[model samples]
Target: MKETDIKELNERIQKESAFVDMLNLEMHKVIIGQKHMLESMLIGLLSNGHILLEGVPGLAKTLAIKSLARTIEAKYSRIQFTPDLLPADLLGTMVYSQKKEEFQVKKGPIFANFILADEINRSPAKVQSALLEAMQEKQITIGENTYSLDEPFLVMATQNPLEQEGTYPLPEAQVDRFMLKVIINYPTKDEEKHIIRENITGAFPETKAIIKPTDILKARGIVREVYLDEKIENYITDIVFATRYPAENKLKKFDGMISYGGSPRASINLALAAKAFAFIKRRGYVIPEDIRAVAYDVMRHRIGLTYEAEAENITTEDIISEILNTVEVP
Candidate 1:
């Protein structure tokens, strides 16, 4: 883009995205810390992608989503995934009506704009698969009738890490549908102190509807319009390719550490997430820093580590760090 156009876009985005700060402030009123997780959630929302959150209990993972929904005035639903959960339980089943004597379609919690699938890993595979269509297709079929989900649809699923003993791990194919997988950590000591003060004093804040779904759609369009030079595109491609063929990318040390590299979807999500990151910062163009900020969350879950690496105490984050450090920036 020319200097004038870039300047205009910058000003326009800055004006339209004023709500970003408001969203942050409102969430902070309720949530203590986890800035990374909060920003990742915004990225997922702006990019129109589903997010999977892995964190232990008391991390405010549930409260964060609720506060976000409250801020946007979007419909919210929380589906508790359990061992006995069935496909029909989540996607809804046909209900027999006494008066009409015909089966009526009773929609499940998936109809909401913001969905919190608590303990998603606790449910069986069959029950989990029920979300595949809704998450990917953005629509659900009920008794031969299809129902389209509301715009700005975002599914934030959380899994408990400490109690994975009886949990059914999400399959790779199922996991790929998510745009990013965020691993949330606990708050800092000072932040925890603030949380304690807030809880004790009953000083919780509410988020208002700063922007509507149409406004979000407009912002998403703007995010796509954010200029990404060819060099940056190549940079993203190289990073993803390294995940698949580490040796070829001059990272031979990671040969056996990774069983498989990130898929094509990983590349797409990485680029989209970078664009969203840039937009979040009110930038008119994407830079290497934008990609770096979101690379771990976008690729961590997508990167399948080998058993050998796990035995050696290596992790997907390690592989991602090496790849990013080795890959030349644009």
Candidate 2:
């Protein structure tokens, strides 16, 4: 808490986070744009949390995750979620061995260090829960055996917009399991020009591994050590509380606009994500700016909008903007 301690921590974080820039350089080799998506993925990786990427097809959502996996020296698996996907298919099922006269555990792709659940909303609820459970527990139970997942295990699930046909919307509770829900946008005109030139000329770049899985595991611990003062904690709580009771927080206009507010997990993720954001910035202490940077992604899926808000074309983005503008920053 002292000034000298902060100085020491800052130096240490600066040294620890030096690899971040190199990792970013490697990712940009293949990815043309979507800097926000890449940064959110890094925050999730550093905070030991899962991410949900929602965008229309061909926006590089899947490519970004693939490029990230390529940059890290870890196991990666991409599972395509379909309407007929079963729980056993995601979490390994028991297999009978004739020679051994017993059932052998055949682990599913969930055992990998990094998982890409492609088109997650295409699957049924049971299949979705199977993946979500593994994401939360960080383990899988096959038959009678419980297998702990490998360290630095992170899941990046991509889903098409719910308006897409034949898509099953994830349940509220199920969706809440994700730490961050990022909405990807199309590239800018200049960025798109480069994208077209690269593809047309067959000049797509390949990302090389810059860090190992252990490096990420170590960084996660350091991210937690990033200082969060009481003022910042109070700021996080107040923002989350305002989502529940807008009238009490000086945002009375949103009384009926929000049917439900964020849960306790929202506050927790917000704090953790803010700390991680600070770490990514190579800082040892968290600031209000860090919290603001991640608030939209952390709370977007958690807030439930009312029919009145929808009728007025009010979105969670609008409510969050008001909360940030009205809530006094620490």
lDDT of each: 0.89, 0.92
- Candidate 1 lDDT over residue span 95-205, tens digit each: 999999999988888888899999999999888888877899888888899888998999999887789788999999899999999999888999989988888998677
Question: After superposition, which runs of candidate 2 have C-alpha atoms over 4 Å from their true positions?
Answer: none
What TM value does model 1 have?
A: 0.97
Lowest lDDT 10-mer window, candidate 2?
A: 159-168
* Tens-digit per-residue lDDT, 268-306, candidate 2: 999999999999999999999999999999999999999
TM-score of each: 0.97, 0.97
Colliding residue pairs in candidate 1: none
Question: Which candidate ranks first by TM-score, i.e. highest?
Answer: 2
Which candidate should be chosen as best, given lDDT against the real structure?
Answer: 2
Error of 2 at 2 (Å): 3.9
Which lDDT value does model 2 have at 223? Answer: 92
